[model samples]
Structure formats: structure tokens, C-alpha cells
Target: MIVKPCIAVSAAVGLTSSALVGALHASGPGGLPRGARGTATRGGQGMEATGSGFDLGDWFKQAFTPQTAAAVKKKAGTSTAKKAKAPSGRGCTDAVLVLGGTGKTGQKVVEALLKQKRDVVVASRSKESAAELYDASTPGLFVQSGVDVRDEATLKNKALFDGVTQVVSALGPRFGEEGSSSEAVDFQGVQSAIEAAEAFLEQGDGSSAAPGDQERVLVAPGDSGSDERGPGGAWQPLDDVIMGGRSSSAWQKGVGGGVLERQSGKTFGRWAGTLVTEGGGFCGTVIKDMPFDATGYDGIRIRVRGDGSRYKFRLKPDTKLDNTAERQYQAPFDTVKGEWIEVDLPFESFVAVKRNYVDFNAPRVNEGPAGGKMLSLGLVLSRFGFNEYPNPKYTAGAFQLDLMEISLYKKPRPNFVLVSSASAERYHRLTEEERKNDIPIVALNPGGILNWKYKAETSLRKSSLRHCVVRATGLIAEGKEGDESVRLQMGQGDTLSGRVSREEVGSTVAAALSSSYSAGKTFELRRDEAEDATGKTPDFTSLFRGLVLDEDRSLASAGGASLPLPPFAIVQDPPPPVTEERKQEILNDPRVKARTAASKKPE
Candidate 1:
């Protein structure tokens, strides 16, 4: 399909921004941030926010002190407001650096800065054949600097940190890539970025450096101060975005935006100490991580908007305490759903002099027995209201923010640029405009980004993103001398209750399915009348609920049984094969075993 020029342009510029490009991991497809999120009710679609540019130096000056300036920036020179060409990335720092940029969050940072017209460089080892990679380029937004992240030189290359002020790392290990210990990319990557910044700042001559002799780190912090910073619309400086003012209730937590329901003219949200007005705001957090350098800079700033309800800003910094424990930060905001309100936090508000939230490395626990920092930001729609009587008429309308612009310096920085796109800059640059329209199909393990087997296959042109299922059965091909395929899509627990009794064919079908669905959402088998079935298809929705989300799938044929769990499912960790004894137990479960037995007595 021809991508509209407007969207293509926004995506082009956004993807090309260094901030955006760097934030993206080498992960594929959903590899990096693109400044927007997918909303299901909206058909997984959204409007674009074109990021524009600003003067970085001006903003930098306004926000930092000379000491910070000397430590972060190498050039004592000036920033030209007239869209100066970005610093030529000629010299690499002695430190190896990883740019973990991209996704909705990183996209905003990159495009906002790029609107200021910064040259963006993205690095991820694309496994496209050399021929394919060259042809698959997205111009304007992509300057492919192929750097192997696993290599030490990636960090030590001095050319990376030229004119670099602060290192704002938006790095995090993605869904499939992190090893048990590789999560350290955050702890270690930030340190390396610091080393590079230092080398860049101290390059050429032994210049008199920073006042405190410490490098200022630009990390996304977890909490804010707890003091009472009284006000109406002065913006609350906390990282909490809540669903409803946080109820100590577990049932309502993951229900999306169900926390606050407005009935009649009055709306009531409940929490310990949050109050609401026509323009109140709230933020609840699901923090997972934070940086080591906690107190060197100013407090946190976040962008917010919603039907104004009294909001409570919660913080969960990782310290000696368990992860779920939360301390309230100053919660204030005069919010209107349609606008982006900036909340500036003076570190003083978030300071809990006695209780600090910092846990360097804690064992990861489910209910969060394993604690980290408050890396997550949540929202609660209502809190601290007059009455909970006739639950007020609730409006479930949706609210969204294009980007959160956080200025960490004590004040705004002078000469800093706020770059944005004509439509969320750089999203366009992700795909090869030359090839985006021609993306006939994409394989799940395409380029082998995830080391799992049973590659997922789907078409780009279909309305339903979950278009088709692809599998390499290595099947015993006896069909008219070649290979052919048939795809089936059904809801969870819905099954094709075929009464065929062939155990071999049932097992083959199970094998085929196992190659496709790993540990994913629930899905049931359905018999589509439209499908040209070689035999009778099974009833889908009515039979397959319990078998959907399992690590393995069990099916019961008339005479024998088989289990089909797509390779993606984690059945008995990749090693130490499951003993046949356990396999029998799986098939024995009445809920899991599919009720199809295949043809007329083929046993």
C-alpha cells in the first residue's frame, strides 16, 4: 500500500533523528521507539504528532551551570540558532557506547531534538544479506552505522561522543533478547556512556573541568520529592501515571483505565491523599528499574493530560525495601484532556531524606519480591473525591500524550533544540520507502532476531494483523509432487472437534501447530467453511480455552492423543527433554486434550 506522504515524511524525519535512532535496539519490527503507541480499540492505529526543532544550546544554557556545561560538552564554543550542521561525528570516544533509543518514549526525545535538525545515526546488525541490506535503506531518517553491540570497540570508539553534552540513555533489554545476566546493559551501558562523555569533554587539552569534578548523568529517574509544594496549576513533578487513584486493590489494577468512573456531574476517585478539581491530574507507576547516579541533577518532569481528576503521584525507588512499597510524591496538576501540561519537579519535593529508593541489583520477584527502581509510569483517573454514593456516570473516553518533555537541568537549558516532526519525526525512516509498499510478507524470526524456532509468518496488506500462520513441517510431502499451504486463525479454546481417529495425522497437525504458537495469548481452533479443507475442519471457539496459553498443547484423538505447542512455547526449558512419563500426564488432562480423532478408522 502507498504510505501517505504526510505520514511517510513524519516517520522519515523521526527515524533519522539520533535520539530516536539511538534509542532503538537491534531488535526487529518493534525494535525501537517511534513516538506513538498502538491502541486496539482504534484498530491499532493512531494520528501522528510531527515533532519540530528548537535551539539546544539556548535550552542547555538555561538549564545547566558552567560546571555541568564543562563536564558534558567538549566545545566551549557556541550553538548557532540558525540550524547549525550537527557536530561531525569524526572522533570516537575511548569508551564504548550503546544507544538504547526508540519506541514511543524514545521516539519523542529523538524527534523533539531532531526537529532542531540533528543528524541521527541508528545501529543494529541487520542480518539482511549484504545485497538486501543495501537495498533496504530508509533515506533521510537512517544513516546506518553498522556497529556490533557485542564488540568492545563499540564503546571505545572515540568518534561517537563528539560535541556530546549529556548521555540520556533510554536503553532497556527487549522482550526476547535479554539473557539472565544481560539486563546489566542499563547499569553498564550508562557507565560506558559516561566514560565516553568524559573523554569527549577532556579531549585534546587538559582543560580545567567540572566544579564538583563529577559527570552529570541524564538518567530517567524513578521518584520525586515528598514535600508539600502547594499550587493549582504549577505542574506536579512525579513519574506516577495512575489508572484510578491507586486503591490498594489488586483486582482493579490491570483493568486498563477502570480506576476512575465519573457518574452524573460528580466523579469520585479514591486514594490516601489525592484531591481533584476540574483540572486535577494523577500518575501511578509500575517501576522496574532506575539508574545508579540518583541525586546529581534536578527532579523529574513529565507531560500529562486527562479529564481533570484529583491525581496521586506515586514513586517506587529501589532501596533496601521490597519493590511494591510506594511513597507518595507531590501530586499536582491542572489538566485538560486535550493538552500537554508540563510538570516541573524541584528535587526538593521528591526528597525523602530518611527513605531513599535505590536497589542496584535485586532478585526479580513476581509480586515484586524482586525490587528495582520506579521505571514505570501509571495513571489513576479519579481520587480523593467528596462521595462514593451513586457511583457517578463514568466516561471511558481515551486520553493520550504525544510525548513527555523532561528538562532535567535545574532550569531550562539555553541553546537546546526541541525537534519534532511534521508527523512524529523519524517513524517514516524505519522502513525502506523504496520497499515499504512491497513488504509482501515478514517472517517472525526474519533475520533471526529471536533465536527461537517456528518462524511466525504474516502479510502486511491484511486488515487483521494476525493474518496467517506459517510453518515448515518438513512434512512427508506426498501432495502432487510439491509443497502447498493452508492457514487457519481462531479464538482461544475454540477447536475443530473433528472425529478422525488417525493418531499419526493428528500428531502431524499438532507438530505443525507447535511450530507456530509458542507461549503466546490464548487461541482456539476453528473450522472455517471458507477454508478448502482436505477433510472436515473442527469447531474452533467452543472447545479450546484451557489449551491456549499453555507452554504445551494437548489434543485427544479418538484412539490416541497428541500435544502441539508451537516452538515459541517454553516447554521444559530448551534443554533436559521432558520425560515420556510427564508427556503422558499432559495428554491425560481432560481440559487440554482436543476432541478430534481425524478420519474413518485409519488406525
Candidate 2:
């Protein structure tokens, strides 16, 4: 099959080839060791080495003999103490350094780590910009300034990875941009990160086969400030205590907004305002100089219950002065009145409102570094009495808007990531236009970037690090109309065609990164089926199960009782020496001659 030949090229570089390659390991497709061939004979068969360094007995001992804390401490002697004590005044934790943390997918990855409460360090050219792109309110966020992955100097900085264990490179050049081209960032930068990791492992910490190396110290979120908040802590009360007079003086009577506490530690806001005339404007109590930094978060989220009234949520940037309309960003929201509902107001959805009038022509509210530094947040009840609820029946009395939790959220990032890359097959067939204009494509011809990417994949496969490689046809964020669920079609030949959401692509990358089963395997990813495309996530477990490891494929094809794990060794004790009569019979067997002949070929 064409796939078998293609698989051979990939498998040669540490991936799994066809059953033909498995033949080199043992007998038949299963590669089962038989009679422990070539062992020295004693009274009985002696144990033989298979040159794989696979010591069965040692494997069992390591697997069954659990290493208790005492055992680990004893093994390290006093070196463990020295490792635990970081240099005085060094603020570092076992962090996952996310390069390109301000990018779309990069930011999401950071958010996911924060959600897991894992310590994270964002590495970018500007730490300030990176911080603005992340939720500084999230306790574990630390910014590493002046980190250009392509720069060898930065990569060689010994302290760069001081507490870093995992380094995720979402590094890619911005589309159609000049500086930071793919050759520089994606190719060379990735190589630099890998080399730096290797150097760090060699010089800074010795390799130990433990799950997470003991030398890497990590900080928990609770240890930071993320999970801590209370009344009088972040939220504060408004001045004047009256509503209409603050926003406008159109009404004879007014309303007030304050906090109400529930027995379960949940607090709701109390907004009761009365408008006597045609119209009234009331703005709620404002919060100033919020202790938390909301960098990187998408927008503010509020849970509220109101009297079915239309309300406006306003945010003031750079100033704490009350009732200021100029330079304020506002988004209108409707309340359900009786039942509490959560509303997400993304930063992009907000518009600038100056001098109590909307500026429709103003640019999208800036969310840049300085733009995200919000000075105040409050609720506005502008135009609610006459313009909105003009029926007089529901217009004049007290209007209430209850507020529950108010915080910020970003699009949740997937735990694992598997980039859906362009298939190697595409490069095999060059169009007339491709041949004429695509110099880079032609230069990398017949293979293109696929070869470069596969080279990286081969490195990963050869390494002990756990990883997954997903080859995708094309990626799009939004599917064509009527398509909802992200479909996963797997093939080895890379002949599949279609596009999938950038969302699904990012999600798949995240999924593959986290799945143990995905390690040491490659997959062709596509999502062409339009029937089940309701934006539903496909069954990832089953999808990943299809990309079984080579070892797993071999075992499945062997078709017998499941092999027992550890204590289950590869190289077995040699069998007893055959008698002259038995040896004569074995020598006469045709299968033995074939096996013997096959083994004699130079490896």
C-alpha cells in the first residue's frame, strides 16, 4: 500500500513502520520472544541480552517497588535540600513558559493553565504587553520580559528556564507580516527552545526518570491571590447614595445601589431607583483602582436579576472621577428581572461613549496595554424611565437590578493541544501556479514544510517526552452554514481533504498534548462531514484511540489474551539445550530454516 511506503519514511525516523519493521524485533507480527535465542547454556537456559537495554527484572523491580518519600530522599542524600532552596530573592516557580503568550491560541493556553491553578510565566518581547494580554488578577501569572525565542542570547540565559519545566512554543509569525517570519520564529526559534531545554537538562539538573523532576519547584494558585476575595475587599459602595442625581436630574425622586449578602457567602447588589418624570439617569456605585489586574481577560462578566429593564454597563478607563461619560466604554444589556442571568460583555463589543452620547464612528474600544487598565466599573440606568419603559404603568416606580458575581473570563483554553498541520501529500502535487510563483514551496518541493515539520516530529518520537503529532488538511474557525460538530477523520496516507475550525484545531492540539494515549503516534486530521456539524465536540477518546501506538497495534494484531504489564519482560530466560535427536528434528523443520535464514541478514 502507498501508506505503508510513506509510513516507512516516517517510521525510519523513530515512528512505527509496517509489520515488516516489527519483524526485526521478535517472531511474527507480535514480536514475541521465543526460546531466548543466542543465550549461553548452563544447566538450564541463561538470561540473554536483546541489545534493547530492556532488562526485564530491573523493569519489574522499578515498577513494583514503589519509591516512597524516604527512598527518594535517601537516593538524593542532602542534594534534595540544596535543590529545594532557591537562591535568596529569586521569585521563581516550576512554571510553564508560554512563548507568544499574547497570540490568540497562546493566550488561551495561558488561561487554561491559570484555570488549573498551575503556575505560569509568560515570555514575550515586552513583559508589560504580555501582562496586559493575560489576567494579572490570576495569581499565578508572571511575566518574563525581553524573551525573544529566536535570539540565542535569550535562549542561552541560564536563569531563563530556572523554574520552567514545560516550554510550549505557540510561536509563529503574524499573518502576512514582515518581521518574525516563519523561518525565524517557527523554525529557528523552535530549534533554539529545544536546544536550550537540552542544555538546561545537561548542565542544571541531572536526568531522573521520575514523572515530574523533583528539582522543579511549583507554586499553587491558592498560594497566590486568585481564590481570595471578600466584601469590602474589591467591590466598594458608591458616593451620594442616590441614583438620578448622579446620571441626571430629570426625576424628582431617585434610587440607590448597595450590596446584599446571602447566607451562602454569595452577595447580590441592591439597585432601587424611582423616577418621577419622563426620564432619569442613575449610575451605580463605582469601584476604583481595583486591586486585581485584568490583563489578557476577554471581557467583564456580570450575573444579575432585574425587573425586565434594559440597562447599560459602563467602564471608565484611567480615571476614578464619578459620573464621567467622556472616554467611557459602554455596552447595553437587558435584564430578566426575576431570575439571575450571566452576561458576558467582551471588550470588542464595548463602544466609546463621550458626553452622554454614543460615538458610533469611534474605533473599537482599545484593549491595548494601557487600554486594559480600568479605573472604575459601574451600572447605569440611563433613559430607562421614559424612553425605554414609557408605559407609566412600569415607568415611575422603583426599578431594581440585582447583581451577583462580577468578574472577567476568557475563552476557555483546552488542556492539551494538537496542531492540525498541512498534510505532506499536498506538497507532492504542485499546480501550474504553484510551480510558477511559489518559490519557497518549489524549493521545499515534493515535500515542502512537511519535511521540516516531520523532522521535528521525528525528534519528539525519539525523545522520552510525551507528545502527539496531528496532520490536518486545512483549518478554519467557522464552519460553513449548517455544519456544527467538528468531525475527525483519520488516515495514514494524508490524502484526505477539507477544512476545520481554527477553534477545533487549537482544541485538538490541546487535547493531544494532554492525552497519554496520544504519545508516540501520528494522525491525519480532517473534518469534512457536514451532517453532525453543530459545533459539538467529537468523542476525543475514541478519536485518539484510533491513533494507537505501534506497540498497541502489534499487540492488537497478535490476537490473544492481553499481555501482562511489567514483571512482563521482553528478553526471557533461555530454553534448555536441545538433544541431538531434537536438534536434528528442529533443523529438519522448514520454518526454523526460514527464521534462521532471515536472522542472518546484516542489520
Candidate 3:
């Protein structure tokens, strides 16, 4: 009767039998099911006797009736939905191991990695659970279970991380679990994973060797003849004289007798120049007709001895519009008088310049279409730095520089990429009102998750391996219609607060692994509700480039510092002034005339 119908409604919503009884009691006695009124009594207690009082026997009978079972089955069927499709791609060259891959956030990370065409290994405690969650047949994705971070032995198993070059620790703590507490899983577990990953990367392929030790040598000492890796053109002069400047320079093959001869009997190139600041203030030697492709290398390294003067090293790209004034990428380095030293010039440090003026719009030396194929190399003693800044060490005198070797070197990629919480820093700093408004912060703070995360981060920072820490704020689940319209925002000083989709966090982690700019940096990541999300892909290069390194002076001060303003936000200084007479002389020069005529007669 009415009681049976009430039981079906309660059971459909997953209510317990005790709750059903309470529901029936709230309905009047006149609304009871098909049981008679009870009148039974035992000792001092009144019992359910037929039609007189409440009867437990009749209640149980009504709760599990056929109608109640059908309602429960219908509810379960409605709740089940079709699973999303898994990513498909070819096997990846480099494998990335994802810890806690079965967790809500971890699955998003795995999905993002798969979309990036990276081989992904999901570490889980239950193989069956991971199998049910993901398509086992998908290429570039492998599931490895029994990976408990608490057990160092499990993490240390070599087979589990065989081809893994990077590790993304998405592990979160399991509260109230005996063995998987915050300290055990968050701090100690992450520390163990880092150690294991470092050992695997270093010992696997000798990536930890000194820079240029096992690398390809583009130019070797005591050799001028062309080899497979050396330049094909002979060293020549391309000084400011071409632009009507009185500055002059020469290149020769002997040691030129100084600390260089004393250290080695090997022959080296000598670049000696005289600076004349009257017309132009630069001198340089150039090597043309030689194409050098620096595809896999990170930067150039040169061994030189100089007269305590600052000089610029430049690379000219092979472009179709060669007759035009193509910008060259240049970076400055200083040398000690008569002392031979090696200088490292990373490709990212070089800026594009034409006629002593920097072109901020041009791509860096390591980027753009022609960046990989370089046509010429130049060594210049310049009176100017980037953006029209005067070089402090410039002097109008003779300068002698000795070059022993020139080669390309690669720095190792990050070994560990940790996905931590932004709340680790903001939880304690939030006001009472802020705390009340944020549910995640309120729930995570009392569990001491922040303390454990801080400990893990400190260990990672102190470790020798290259690392990146991405602290995400308020991770929102995928398919949140309200969140999809927001854009991603990154900041420092823990000052940003908002929701970010878990998928975006995974994409950020994948981007950080291959970027040298991301190494040794920690910043907060969130989404901006004010800005609408766009269809265009994010410029991760610019995003990583904008972040300040951990050792930057701004972050060392008390209370820390706010994020630096964007590159476009800063005011640019004016270019150095050029008089009409000097400009006319440069335009009328024989070199300029010949180049113009050649370009006009082009293909």
C-alpha cells in the first residue's frame, strides 16, 4: 500500500532501511502499508501486534518488495553512461611515467600526455581499475600497476621505468588511510620518486656528463680543414670598414704568443682588431659560404684568450633575401687579458640585430625558420650592446683575441616535473572570509597537506637534478561548461586564486619537460574568469620565457615580489642616433651598392 510505495522511492535514492522507517513514521499511522494495527505487549514494552502498533516484520517485507527492486534497478541504469574515447597515436620516442594515473586529476594528465604523442606509463595500485578506466589497446599508452610510492622498492624497480625520460608525480594523499597518510604519500613518496627518476636518467644514457664532453664538436682545436662537423669556409674579415667605419680587424692561424702558447703547443685562430669610433664603433671577422646545422644542440661554446675586452659572437642565417639587410643573432661575452677561458652562449641568449639596432620582433637564435641552418659566424669587438645600450668595456684601442675551439653543447632536460598544489602557500595566508569561500582550502588545510608538500618541494629544490614545480590552483574537472570559457593565467608570489581545468595542468607539465626556460623555476598556475578562452593554442614559449628564475634577485627580498610585468608592458628606450653624414656614407659605400645591385638582378 502507501508504505510499499514509500520504500520504493527511498530505496531508489539509496536510503537505508532505518531511514525508510523514519520516513514511514513521519507519514501518519493512517498511511501505513497492508499490515493490521498491532496490540501485542511484552513485559513493560509495547510490541507491534498486527493492526495496533508499528511492526518491523511488515516493514522489512515492504522494503524489499518487487516494486522497490525495480525502482533501484532503473536508477542504476540511468546513472551509467558511455565512457569517453581514448587517444590514438604512434609510439613515442621518449616515455613519460605518470604517478597516480588512476586518480581524477592524474587521468587528465595522462590524457594530455597521450594527445601530445608522448609514450605514457600509468602507475596504479590496481591493474584492473586502470584497465577499466583506459583503453588498453591505445598506442603510446601503457598501464603498470602495483606502484605504491610508499614502498621505495616498488619505485626503484627498473622494469617499471625502463624507457622513461621524465616523471610527472601527480600523487595525492589518501586521508584516514593507515599506511597512506599525508606525510607518507605526499612528502616521502614524492621524494622517493625523484630519487629513482634521477638515477634512471643519469645512469641510463650518460646525460649527466659535463656539457660538450660527449657532444658533437663543430670546430676543433688545431684544425682548419673541413670535416663532417666543421665549417666549410675559411675565416675572413667583415669589419665595420664595409659601412665606412675606420675600425679594422684581421684573422690569422698562429697562437699570437701569450697564455695560449704557454698552455698548449696547438695552433689556434687569432683575431686582432683596432677600434675607431669616428664613423662606426665595431670590428669583426666573418666566415661565409659554410653552412652549419645546429638542430639538436643547445648552444655554442668557444675557448678564447682576449685583451680584457667585451666582444660579440654572431651567427648569420641562410635566408632567401640574403642581399637585403638580414638581421644577425648576437650575444656578448667578456674575456680576461691574456687568460684563456671558455665561454658558453646559449642559443636563447642571442638577440636579433641589424646595423647595431636590436629587432625585438624577430625570433631568438634558437627559434624561427632559419634558426636551425646557420650560414656564417662572426666575432666582433663592438662599442654597443643590445637595445642601443653602450658597451661598458669598449675602448678605442688595439684588441687581440685567440680562439682555440668552437663547438655546440646540449644541456640535459629536466628529470622530474612535480604537480603540486598552490594551496601549499596560500592556505595559511588566506583571510577568514577567503577561507570560508574556498571549499578545497578549508578541507585540505586541516589535514596538514600543505606542510607535507612544502617538505617535498624543498627536497626537490635542493637536489642536483634539473627540476620544475608547477603549483596548480583549485583543479576543476573536465567538461565543466562554466570553466571551459575561462583562460589560463600564471603568476608568482602565490598571489593568484581561481579555478583551472585539470587537463590544462597536464599540458603545462608536458610543456615544461622539453623547455630549458622552465628549468629551475616555480610559479603558480590558475584560470582567469575575466578573460574568455580562445581557440588558438597557447604560446607556451612566451609563457615560460616570462617567468623569473628561482634565484632571481626579486624573489630573494623580504615578503617576496610580484610577477614581472609582461614584455609589451615595459617602455622601450629609443635607438641610438645616427647623423645624416654618416648615414649617407653608409648608403653610398661600395659594399652596399654592390649588394643592392645584386638583389635587384635576383632570380
Q: What TM-score fits each model?
A: 0.21, 0.37, 0.64
What Cα-based lDDT does every candidate model obtain?
A: 0.26, 0.42, 0.56
Judge candidate 2 at residue 440 and give its lDDT: 22
Q: Candidate 3 lDDT (Cα, whole model)?
A: 0.56
- Alpha carbon lDDT at 9, candidate 3: 4
- Sequence-dependent TM-score of model 3: 0.64
Q: Number of backbone collisions per candidate, in order?
A: 147, 23, 10
Report per-prediction Cα RMSD to one decimal.
26.1, 21.7, 22.9
Over 419-520, each residue of candidate 2 has an lDDT whose tens digit, in order, gives 324433333444546533332212222112334444444444445444455664433321122345555666443445444433454456555544444555
Q: What are the per-residue Cα lDDT tens digits for candidate 1 across 114-202?
A: 34333344333321211111122322233234333234355555554443332333332222122201223322333343344445532
Model 1, C-alpha of 164: deviation from truth (Å): 1.3
Off by over 4 Å in 2: 1-94, 115-117, 174-179, 201-420, 425-451, 462-464, 477-493, 533-535, 550-603
- Sum up the clashes in candidate 2: 23
* Better candidate number, 2 or 3, judged by lDDT: 3
Pick by lDDT: 1 or 3, better one:
3
lDDT of 3 at 434: 76
lDDT of 3 by residue, 1-603 (tens): 000000000000000111111112211212211221122212111111111232333333332222322111111222121232322322332456667665445666666766755555555554444444456666545554556777889787766555455666777643323355456767888889888876664324433222123345565534535242221226667777888999887754334322124346544566786898877788877776668777656688888888888998888777643432467888899999889898988887788887667888887675677657778777888887776688898778788888777777666556677777775555455565774444333321423556676677767877876677888765442234243334567776565555565577878887776666677777788665553564435666667767776556254332234544222112122123334563454345343343234323323
